[model samples]
Target: MAEDFDLVKIMESGLEGAEYNKAKFPGLVYRIQNPKAAFLIFTSGKVVCTGSKSVENAHKAIITLANTLKDIGFDKIDLDPEVHVQNIVATADLKTNLNLNTIVMALGMENVEYEPEVFPGLVYRIDAPKLVVLIFSSGKLVIAGGKIPEDCEEGLRIISTEFDNLGLLS
Candidate 1:
């Protein structure tokens, strides 16, 4: 949930290392090293936490920031701010080399984008799990745009199933 924040008050309250320069950036940047997350706290109280390796870590970081805000005497801060995972970028390996041209041809032209001249990885967008996977020739895949961590695994499973059906796993 988003609430309004007095950025000036938060700044003057000695929030260690919290930077708020309206001219440079629109929101205040609060960083935590333990969970390895950075938050863009806006005047509208919209907190965008990034750089956390996992969903649990991101939630922990947000709670840490909220507690910090409360300790700074910010009454409007919610101790339990609702966190929404926008995207989860993850990587996986198929353990076998892939021929981009053949895979692209078999995967169909509707959901695949393989512009070798523009980018080396083949961009494959799946509608089921609703995520994008970048397939490389070296069997590495970078799955992005997932709302949850499971989405990445589901995408990989879907890819594996498709490849298996097409006899491309070998």
Candidate 2:
């Protein structure tokens, strides 16, 4: 059984502690790296915790860490309530190279957008809020936005299933 750790209390205390020593600890508290990256570290006693890199990866890593702790018989210990995500990479690759324009045409451009920059790619804002379909010129496909790790896993599984059904891998 998961311990009932009041996340709110932990967050409030952590913020207070972090704010109290902001001068000595740069990037110790809440610091946004960009629109999609960040770092978070908060220590409460022996639980020295750190999570950085895209929000998605951070959550996954933290959950895995928590499970490991629990498995090691630290069920009574509550991890810090605040979840930190520092990086989120969105990319994908299909067995067959897909044309961005063609895919957009099939999916309709109303819900999708494309951009040009350091990492130029097309972004598909599907109906699902927690899901994003990213297509790149290098034949890399990325699926990001699964709020829960299971959701991400499901998404990948569904992709793989579809690929199998269509013999895309063969």
Candidate 3:
């Protein structure tokens, strides 16, 4: 989070090559290449970090930003900022081809949406893990909207069990 950040001062400090264009975008886009993450720093002390493959990488990016700000004479930055994992996306392979039509019928209309002409995959919304899993005909699955890695794993397990019960696999 960018608490009361003076973007002008930060830009003048020349600590890092950060992209800031108030007229074009409200947030300062600071990118770190090591862990591969981009931080969107807004004037309202709101920061949104994205593109990190894992939560640890995200935390590293935030910490690095805070330290850089402090080193650049920005004193209001919190050394230990409160971090939260808003979402986690994961992918897996079921190892057997899926029949979208059959799986849709077995999983029920409310939870599954499959239109081959519009999309090649089926969108399966799972409630317990509170995430959406994309099931493809080639046995590929993409799980999204998970707060933690475990949530994604749990979602995969749940869906695998459901598919097994319905005999939808293969």
Candidate 4:
């Protein structure tokens, strides 16, 4: 449910902490420090907020932004709008270096992509939680494409268990 927003009005208002450069980016960038989040406000009234450490923090930041907008004369701003989380990213360590070759073989070729020339890390996809995990030789793993925190945790558990069952973890 997006509406047409007056980008020129917002920019001409000379707001304290908002930057808009249409030639560079079509959205107005508004940032807040408390939750360490940045939002991209589009003329279509769609706001893309990122960099919040947790879902709660993201909600807080959005509410704050909505309030600020209302105060700044955007009366159309909804104080209790429906929020949708795109994805959640999480990281972990295996405590031991992984052999990409072994992982590729054990995990199967379909859900795993490890091309050393193209990418240094192996891309492992999980179906249950619908996540993509990046496995590196240094034992560091980055899990992404999760809808919620629990999805991330579940994906990690699935991966760790797979490696553990195969005697891959030391």
TM-score of each: 0.86, 0.44, 0.87, 0.92
Tens-digit lDDT string for candidate 1 (1-170): 34788888888998888899999999998888988999888988788999999999999999998888888787767789888899999999999999999998887899999999999999999997899999999999999999988889999999999998999888
Question: What lDDT is reached at residue 6 by model 2?
Answer: 35
Per-residue lDDT of model 4, residues 33-143, tens digit only: 987799899999999889899999999899988887887788888897788999888899888998999999887899999999999999998888789999999999999
Residues 1-170, candidate 3: write the lDDT tens digits: 54677877777888575899999998888888888899888877778889998899999988988888889997888888999888899999999988888887877899888999999999999998899999998999999999989999999999999998898765
Candidate with more favorable, higher lDDT: 1 or 4: 1
Q: How far in Å is the alpha carbon of 96 misplaced in model 4? A: 1.7
Highest TM-score: give the candidate number.
4
Candidate no. 4 TM-score? 0.92
Q: Give per-residue lDDT, candidate 3, residue 128.
A: 82
What lDDT is reached at residue 114 by model 2?
67
Q: Tens digits of per-residue lDDT for model 2 on 6-75?
A: 3344445433333324456522343222232223333432222333444555555555545534554555
17 in model 4: Cα distance from truth in Å? 4.0
lDDT of 1 at 140: 96
Q: Local distance difference test, per candidate?
A: 0.90, 0.49, 0.88, 0.88
Clashes of each: 0, 14, 0, 0
Which run of 10 residues does model 2 get worst, by summed lDDT? 30-39
Clashing pairs in 4: none
Q: Which of the predicted structures, 1 or 3, would earn the higher lDDT when compared with the native?
A: 1
